[model samples]
Target: MTELTGTSTGQPPTVDLGPYADALTHNPHPVYARLLEKSPIHRATQPDGTETWLILGHPEAKEALSNPSALSSDPANATPQWRARYLGDPNARELPQGKSMINADSPDHARLRKPVQRAFTPRRINALRGTVEEHADQLLQGLPSDAAFDVIDDFVAPLTLGMICTILAIPDLDRDRVRGWADRIGFPTSAEDVTAARHELIPYTDQLIADQRIHPGQGLLSELIEATDDGQMTPTELRATIFLLLNAGHETVISLLASTVFCLLSHPDQFAALRDSPTLADQAIDEALRFQPPAISAPPRFAREDCTIGSTTIPGDGSLVTVVLSSANRDPREFTHPHSFDITRPPGELLSFSHGVHFCLGWSLARLEAGIALPALLNRFPDLAPAAELSALKWRSGPIVRRLEHVPCKSGARSSAAPPHNN
Candidate 1:
């Protein structure tokens, strides 16, 4: 509760995200560390006059998140602007609040997550390991031999976009559109860009939802649809759940995988060290998530009753809790040497996914994807180095995360990182 070095009470911060978007597109560490230590819970004012509490401290973040009474992830009474634009209109009977798994409570959450869980079982993921590797290989093969390429475009983006299509049974989805939507959503250009992507994606998803019902197959969406027809969930419930699956499960992996690779490439010795011990790649993924988590902030939370997070007392019912996820990932109260990227760092301390029932359900999927991709990439291009001016590289300055705009690197480029790989 001590005042960190340079924080001064000024205007409350809004989720305008122009700066955050830029930082993410560039590098956001120094800013995030500053915010976390000094202002664990800074006051922010949004353009809509909506005030937000930015929980930047790691311990404070975990406390705020686990406090069920204080943070409500549901959008039942969300701002009209958010409801209409993101969740769809309720009064208009278009996209109602109770239509999805995300907006559901405990019993509902269990019910919705249960069936989806069955489809995304560990066995299912393990089975896809080879396919995932092949997918990575294909993307790598497409890159010009011994040429500089944008890692985001040439590899990470396609693997994720294609993977999502595989999960949804959308065999013929416009790969370009899928990649575009996921990228824009992950590191949006502006607020308008975020809004417009949503508007476009909704109809596209709606159409897909319709097709899944009629011509269902062996994908997550199709499986959910099968569950719905079996009276496991209502049709309306099915569409929203599918939407959540697509939206939540898509770009997060891309951002995480892309960000982790960018981290490795930035620190060539570290990259080479890991290449020498490839299994460390998984731990590196965890470390990268802790060191530079993609989901920069928590989903919106409104107090259901009253609560106290640490010494600060938050008033009842109307309070909006903003979980600074990156802060928690680096909270000294939680991790040993919060800033250092220790791949073998104990998992119990990291909250990059989260810490409760509301924790990321797709965490396994994210880990699996990163585990397969990271080592495989380095194993393939051990001598890789940035072809672009990494010093000139920037992060998108948004509340969401720290992510690179693009990672342009020279494949097979000689480096002092490590000995050339078998590839």
Candidate 2:
């Protein structure tokens, strides 16, 4: 284990985050809290030898993101040597294409995100109300009230995938394919698997875009492809759009849902309180989001131009700065009782979904899924409880998405609603 050499004061010892990797995967709050007290930005070395400036303070993280000039989202700044040093050897799939919306800054990101943004606009997403709710109900339909269930495997993952599938009107997508892509993308053990999945998905999305082009559907993919405007998305961009929608669509929501349920199931009072006060779901989700963010931190960002975070000025184009959201959510400067999960919180303090121009575009959809699925799940399994030992359950590992491998649970009270799959 990495030694905790300093107290909640002084220049904390430069800690190696690897030993705590297990705790980080399952529950990172303790480590996050510890890091926040001493310094918001700490130098950390990974087992892979990559170094990062981990920004845990809320203000610092926001600054790091908002100051695009100082920090670039471009992966191009990452030298081929560095890229190979990290994800290149994962040996799972090939490394993600070097430049996507996530990697590009300014004109590129704006160009890429613009047309697709129209489809995700509040009104457009609001129009999806019925489809979203129907899928929520459908997911609830097959869940067995008295059986043991893995929420990640059987529920959350399916709900997110189905929602994205609907958005793309992908009629023939096998759930297995979606799951495999997720596993490959999220857990990049080897570069081969990562590259293979990334490339494979392009063709998969290409085929969907082609079908949508011929027979446009009521879904967003077709809408984005055929969007009428001066700033239209090219076929390549359309493919990227679908890829982003599919990959980003469900993964975090699944994490948020499963994490929230775990929190509620463990804390019975909160569960009962939520049941009694339906309005609390909004805050409950926010608190859960802050407390157990699905993605602890985003990839290291580089400077496109000169920028500063506090007193430190970053040079133009290639300075690496990471916004460690996990730490930020617990930053004492912004949150009170940051260690505890309280549903009744003032919203602005949390940055789990991020903030500013790069704020997650899928925020509305992710929240809606959680807002619907959780209440429905609880209503069905009123007496649901963890079926497996907390210490025994596995937490999925990655620098990208963090979640449980399985949330095995014994279903409680029978739901009057149709089983999740039946719907």
Candidate 3:
């Protein structure tokens, strides 16, 4: 492990974060806390040997995320060296494959996001409460009564994927393929792998959009296609938009569901609290999000010009600055008892879903799914507990998202007598 050479009161150490990348994936709070205490902003070398700035303070992270003038989301704006080292062949471009709303800076971002924003409004998401409930119930009903099952594969993944597919009108037959592509995109081993996955997925989305053109449906994909017809967006933009929605919609929820369940199961007292007061489900989900956010950090934000965050000066020479959402959510200055997980931690703003114009478009939908699915799962299997030791569980190895390979657990069929509250 790379150790910080300086004390918290001294100059910030130039640490190589590459060595601690695995630790970040497994459990980042301790590492983040240590880094934050030493320096809220530190210059670190990534595993890939690329240098970047990591913002670990709550105030700085929020400012970096919401500051449009100082930072640009577009990779093309990055310094050639920074882009080539991190993204490979900085000049070779075809809009960089997965260039969607999340990556596009203003004007383009505003244009791309405006079309689909209506589909994710509070009113629209709330309408799907019934659908989310039915899917959660059905997934719980299918769990094997006599065998231990992986909560991620048998429950969370399917439930989240189903909800996203339903919202996007993805045909059932395409779901497995979509999931495979999404997995590769989220956790690619190499740049070539990501490019190849994007290559495969873009054409698939193109066909989906083409199909929607001929026969429109009530899903967001069909709605975006209609926008394309009105000249609001091009075919490429439409495909990219749909790709973003599908991956973002499902993957984040999968992490949220799995982590929320893992947290509850690991902390039985908290689980009992939730079961006793089902109304705490939403609060519990928020706490889980703060405790173990799906996306550990926002995508790297390139400095548009020389900008200062806190006491650190970030040069404008294409510096890639990443706001560590996981760190910010646990900042002691912001949240009381930052390390402890309290479902009733008092509702407050969290950086898990990000902030500013680039905030997650699917935030409402994700919250709704967690609120319904979590309570339902716990209530159905009142004695649900981890079959595997928490230390033994395999966690996904990626910088962007934190998730378990599988959450193996005993279904607790014998204790399904009745939950404390099954509302």
Predicted structure 1: lDDT: 0.68
Q: What is model 1's C-alpha RMSD?
A: 5.0
Go through the candidates in order and give the C-alpha RMSD of each one to the true structure.
5.0, 5.7, 4.3
**lDDT (tens digit, per residue) of candidate 2 on 124-173:** 88888887778778767877866787888788887788878877787744
Q: Estimate each model's TM-score.
A: 0.84, 0.88, 0.93
In TM-score terms, candidate 1 sits at 0.84
Give the runs in model 3 whose Cα sits over 4 Å from its true position.
1-13, 85-87, 93-95, 413-423
lDDT tens readout by residue for model 1, 52-71: 67777877888887876456
Clash number for every model? 27, 26, 0
* lDDT by residue (tens digit), candidate 3, 292-403: 8999899778887988888887878778888999999989889999888789888767999999998988888899998888888887777787776666677785547878
By lDDT, the better pick of 1 and 2 is: 2
For model 2, give the 10-residue run with minimal summed lDDT.
414-423
Best by TM-score: 3
Question: Any residue pairs clashing in model 3, and if so which?
Answer: none
Residue 192 displacement in candidate 3 (angstroms): 2.0
Question: By TM-score, highest first, what's the ranking?
Answer: 3, 2, 1
